[model samples]
Target: MLEHLKKEQINPSIIEEIKKYRQKYADTADTSQTSLRYLYYGKEIWEAAVHALLCGENLLLAGSKATGKNVLAENLARAFRRPCYNLSFHINMDASSMIGNDTFRNGEVVFRPGPIYQSAVDGGFCILDEINMARNEALAVLHSVLDFRRTIHIPGYDQIPVHPATRFIATMNYGYAGTRELNEALASRFVILQMPSITQDNLTRLLLREFPGIKKQFAEQFSGLFSDIEKKCESGELTEKVLDLRGLLDALRLIQNGLSPYPALDMGLTNKTFDAYEQTLIRDIITTRISKKTESTTIFS
Candidate 1:
């Protein structure tokens, strides 16, 4: 990962600091998962996030769908060589679920540690996924943990001080259903970075990275197809449901496995929306770049 950072031309000083941090917390490193599936492409975003984490400030990644917020979060954790604990926040998420809850075992009450608590104790990276989905009041428990105090206070248990290497990375997608604006107090606790939508160049790079045997022309066409769908979503002609990067990738994989392009795309992209009219629009967009008779063999070398 450090070598990849050098390839991206991240600041040398920042890279050095990251090395020092890893060395200092070498014992906290978890080697179970060594690499990220996808590498975030934007250099500026990478630099900003790396710098913020190096300064011991938590990060809040805010962006629209398919902007690589979670990808970057995982990449950051991998870059720092820390164990990552993911906590998906919803309406039912509360302090007890986050910090831990009391459970009876062997006729005795035992405190079961949650992701946040485990991450704090182990100096792991805790990913707060879709943080805005949870009510603000439920998040109040994080105030001291995120701020200068760096501690978690449980009423019946001893105070737990956050490990020096522990860092929280929260991701929120604006305008998502059931998601509300994050409260000011929680928002002010971390340095926020606005994630940008994946660019055509980066999309192409991602395809080539994931499928090295894929032909260059097909890669460009696939990425262009996604770009068209994104533009349509922005114009309100189609909902964001069709703008599925994962679906597109799955379609390509299906194509590689012998499915025809159109049917593969139908399973991957067009069928993501149940609306017939929207599916037609998506099919038209797909036809503009991909041939209906394009065979699976033609996609790869």
Candidate 2:
């Protein structure tokens, strides 16, 4: 598969990393068994990111959390063989943290570069993770960096030009509390792509690919459980407890470790959310589903 990918002009570095991770984990296979494979519903988003990388356009990924925005961003970076530096956005983030900061030198104040500055100079990919969570003041510093003439200006220091290979990918979970909306000036700097919830087929493929040896019947049941949780979330019947496919995968692994499915599911998945009532309801739903599946399995076995 690595060889085939290489023939398609895919980055050798990315192909090498994929092979390296697979070998290190001893999980190499022709197909992925992870549930996230089926969760990819935004083909446009994926393709648009790819186009941006090829065309060297900075990108912005906007969606609700757990819709695979960051995952896709990382995957695209891996696929492109571009080194990625993730700048985690937070409320207190400042221009110095992104562009550069002044520091005491041997005998005077010197400019110490930040992740954004380094990535810009290094010609690597910069993932501005959760850009919306950042203060407008912080993002205001990015305006020049993202505009047509790619350059970042630090008031007290030299003006730096970004590398031709440098591309910026910003991701955000809109309407998520604690995040402010993107201001127009900053918003105009990026090409927006909306990410959607994972589709069932993709989710199933991801599970099967991630857990190659897991029983297919169980994989189907797990996928259905995720769908059920999603439905509950849409109906406002549950919190965001069910969006982590990794949690579900771990819960199943725990069951295989001799923990009863109910308890395993609770500890691995439901317990992640703090709402007692919501947690109990999720636990009950998982337990009922597992019982039904187990009974059917027993009859067949």
Candidate 3:
């Protein structure tokens, strides 16, 4: 991962800091997940995130759907070789659920650590996914943990200081359903990064990386198809649900398995929304880039 960072042109000093951090926390930092499934394609984003983590600042990644926010978070954790704990925020999430709660042990009550608590003590990376989905009041618990205080205060027990290698990466999708504006007090706790939409070049790089055998021409078409869907979403012609990178990858996989491009795309992208009208629009977009008779063998090496 450090070598990959070097190839991406990340700051050499930042890479060195990451290397030192890994060695410093070798005993506590979990290295079980050695590598990431997807490498985040943007060098600027990688540099910014690595610098932020090295500075010991919590990060809030604010962006639209399919912008690779979560992907970048996982990539950062893997780059630093830290054990990652993913905590998805929802309406029902609360401080107790995040930090930990008193529970019954073999004979008596005990405090069972949650993801945040475990990450704090073990020098792990805690990914707060879709952070805005929870109420502002529910998220207030993170203020001290994220800020310079760097401590988790359990009401009845002693405060646990966060390990130096522990980092929090939170993601929020703009205007997503059931999400509210994060309060200024809570938002002020971390440095925010406004994530940009995936560019055509990065999209192509992602496709080629994910499917090495896929033809470059087919990869370009798929990238074009995604861009078209994103444009429709921007124009309010379709919801963001159809602007699916994972769906496109799944479609490519199906094509690899001998499914025709159209049907594969229909199942992967068009079928994501049940609205007949929206499905028709998505199908039209797919047809513009992927031909009906395009064969699987032609798409792959």
Candidate 4:
């Protein structure tokens, strides 16, 4: 995969740096962190990320939904051969939850490491998903860790220096319903990269890669369907919840499993949202873009 990236014109020195880190963490690389499907990153985004890693900068992937932020984060971890800890930020996230907490074990309280703590100690790549969802107070523990000092101060335990290779990749979907603006302090700690949604050509390539047997005509229609829904969502005609690439892929999987296209797509796209009005609008979009005839040839077979 790194070789493929090299062919894309990513900096050689940056690739060498990743090679070094991958070797250092060779024994600890988590297979799960590696993506099963090839993650398609735009050339510019790929170059920016590689340089940021060389600088030992934490990454903040700021973008709209379906921009492949999480996918890229996982792909980076794999390319660098690091153990990955996927952490989801929530409204109730707290410092203790991220660092460590006192736990009763063997009749004594012991400090159990959280994802952040373990990643810091083991030189793993920690993926903080939806970084802006957690309250600022809850994210305070990340300050020192993400800064130039690269150390996290645990209240009960003394400051622990993060392994030099440990990196944090955070993602944020700004302007989404529940997302908030990232705090400037945290933003400053990261190399913020604004990600663009995958383009039509890339999306078409992704679809074909995942579903190789899909018919050309139907593939084009499916791609246009997603584009249409994305536009509707962006224009406020549909909710973002209905706009999901995973849903799209899963629906295609359902069709492969012998379900017809309409119902299969419904399972992936329409049923995700419970609102009747929203469902109707989603169905309308699906109806317009996808029809029974699109399933004439079984792509799965």
Candidate 5:
């Protein structure tokens, strides 16, 4: 997996650090089971993440939706050849949910470890997905673990020391609805990387990478369509729901599978917004891009 990243011309020192970590620890988890493959870390964010991780600094990827923060986190884990634990932070996740909780197992209370606890003990890379959604109070437990101290203090248990190789790559979107600002103290713990929106060329390459059978012309069209929707969202003409790369890809898949582009595009773009007026605006954008004869056409046929 790391060999494929050579084309990106990553820093030699970062490569050596990853190799050293691979040699130092036994990687217990296999990331090959997922459908998510062929990640392309263009230039900037890739170097920042690699350098930060090599420096033993925790990583915090801040960006809006569809900037590939989670994908980069997964790629880093695979590149470093380490087990990864994905812990999704929502409004309800508390400190105990992150560390561990005492549960009765056949009449005796036993500590059942959470993602953070296990990652701390076993030295795995834990991806804290949507870290901002977590209440700042709930995430305070992570302070010691992320800092130089590298320890997790459980209220009922002993202060567990983190393994040398343990790392947390957290991702959060600012200004998104239902998201909160991360406390300064927590934000200060990691090397924060502001991820940029992917370029059109990179977006096309990503589509081709994920769906090799997709025609280049259609890939360009899909990329353009996504960019258009994103612009509309940014302009407030449409809601953020339609600005989705995954949805566009899924709609392309549907088209390839014989659905009309209009319906397929609807499934992907227009249907995302619940407001009737917003859906009408979204539909107008789609119709403006895809014509009547074009609607019937699939990728190849």
Candidate 6:
């Protein structure tokens, strides 16, 4: 399945550009405090990401929101020691926004290159984050870049050959509204990896790893709450918008800050989903499972 990477090798110049971009963004990309201790589900997803990257193939990571799709993308780039350029897609995104555009400057139409073009030319790894959110026309710009024939043509500019080391990793939360089906041409060009829901054991490990002194029983309860939410989401009873474990972690942090568990949990996790009824249900779940008191005697402290 990963045959295309070895078959169509990128040029040496493109590889050099990738190295340069890596150096340029070294100060900005922070992966240091990522709790490198990720779950088993994350490991397999990351392994597939690494496999695609090493083989020099563009990757499409398709999954629901808060499923750690972007996290795995960043982790893969860090693991490969590659520089990453993230381009967030939206409904208004355009080809010119991605490739490049021509504008008058000093009475001349100067070509201002976009992130995708710049990243391709520089040989850096470009992550098309939330790709499905954009219209198909906007994503059509990437067809040539993903194919064995390496080129990105923007009108009013030269046909720029993609950098050899420049591979694209696109992520999409399929359950999100206004997202389009990835075009078949585009899909056929790159490898696709479906990310799985994080497991309870891994969530427990993550909680323990991040909040070192938290009690085992407490962590188990929290993990179980997350599992229940996952089941709710899978069954279409709840929206993916409220499924962020990171939000739950933030709520826990707020609890440690003297905020009542009710208020903290409400502010950090449940309220993020936006539906009134769902929010209420989510709050009730947290209140029942997590503590409602804000006393300083936390499970960890």
For 84-171, candidate 3 gives per-residue lDDT tens digits of 9999999999999899999998989999999999999999999999988898888888988988899999999999999999999999
Off by over 4 Å in 2: 1-42, 104-110, 272-281, 292-301
User: What C-alpha lDDT does candidate 6 achieve relative to the native structure?
Assistant: 0.73
lDDT of 1: 0.92
Q: Mind giving the per-residue lDDT tens digits that candidate 2 earns over 203-240?
A: 76667766666677777777888888888888999866
- Candidate ranking under lDDT, highest first, comes to 1, 3, 4, 5, 6, 2
Q: All candidates' TM-scores?
A: 0.93, 0.76, 0.91, 0.84, 0.88, 0.77
**What stretches of model 1 exceed 4 Å from their correct place?**
none
lDDT of 3 at 46: 89
Model 1: per-residue Cα lDDT over 214-297, one tens digit each: 999999999998999999999999998888898999999998888888899999999999999999999999888988768888
TM-score of 3: 0.91
Model 4 C-alpha lDDT per residue in residues 1-301, reported as the tens digit of each score: 6876776677787788778767776776665533447676577888888788867899999988778998899878877777889899999999888988999999999999999999998889999999999999888889999998899998877889998889999999976578798888888899899988776666777887788888766677788888888898889988888888889888988787677888888899989889999988888888887765656355544
Best by TM-score: 1
What lDDT score goes with residue 134 in model 2? Answer: 83
The per-model lDDT (C-alpha) reads: 0.92, 0.71, 0.88, 0.83, 0.82, 0.73
Q: Candidate 5 versus the native: TM-score?
A: 0.88
Worst 10 residues of 1 by lDDT: 28-37
| lDDT, model 4, position 207 | 80
Best by lDDT: 1
* Candidate numbers, best TM-score first, in rank order: 1, 3, 5, 4, 6, 2
**Stretches > 4 Å off in candidate 3:** 235-239, 273-281
lDDT per residue as tens, model 6, 1-301: 1121222243444445445645655554333434443433344564566667667788999987667777777655654444568899998999888887888999997888788887787666788998877887777778888888789987766788987767788998786667678778778887999888778987887788777777888889889989888888788888888888778889878766667667777787788888998988787777777766634356666
For model 4, what is the C-alpha lDDT against the true structure? Answer: 0.83
